[model samples]
Target: MSSDLSLQQIAESVTKSVLNATDKDLEGFQKIIDETIKVRESHRNLQRMIKSYSTTMIQRS
Candidate 1:
């Protein structure tokens, strides 16, 4: 009786721990994705700036 109750408690605790860890992993994954998007956008902006500068130089030449 007591042993069965202990086992049930342990199982519930394990389930809760697994769920919390999964939530943390998802949050971390989302943060990484957001950072990746920011880096990609910055790269695109830099490329546009370079292209514009090149066009201006070509026009002057």
Candidate 2:
């Protein structure tokens, strides 16, 4: 499978695995939330990098 497909599978697994829980799962939930936030920030950075690279290429061309 492609990397996107793999990631989707992993995300689905995590969602399904935690769909039902209680206060005892707080630690697990916190870790997931933090990881998700980090992933989102990383994606934003990647988008910015790509935008900058394309802008420079367009200017040079």
Candidate 3:
């Protein structure tokens, strides 16, 4: 009976640990996704600026 209890306790601990790790991983993924979005937006803005400058230069020429 004691052995059974010990096994159950071990199983619960392992389950909790796995769940915590999964949560941490999800948080990391979300941060990465957010950063990637910001980077993409910045890139788009830079491209727009470059395009506008090129057009202005062409008009001047």
Predicted structure 3, TM vs. truth: 0.64
For model 1, how does the per-residue alpha-carbon lDDT over 5-54 read when each residue is reduced to its tens digit? 57578668767655667767768867977998999999999999999999
Per-residue error (Å), model 2, residue 2: 22
Q: Would you list the C-alpha lDDT of every candidate in the order shown?
A: 0.82, 0.85, 0.82
- In candidate 2 the C-alpha lDDT for residue 38 amounts to 100
- lDDT by residue for model 3 (16-50), tens: 65566776776886797799899999999999999
Local lDDT at 44 for model 3: 100
Q: Write the per-residue lDDT of candidate 2 for residues 19-50, one digit (tens) a residue.
A: 77666796878897899999999999999999
Q: In model 1, what are the clashing residue pairs, if there are any?
A: none
Q: For candidate 1, report its TM-score.
A: 0.64
| RMSD for each of the candidates | 16.9, 4.0, 16.9
Q: In terms of TM-score, how similar is model 2 to the real structure? A: 0.62
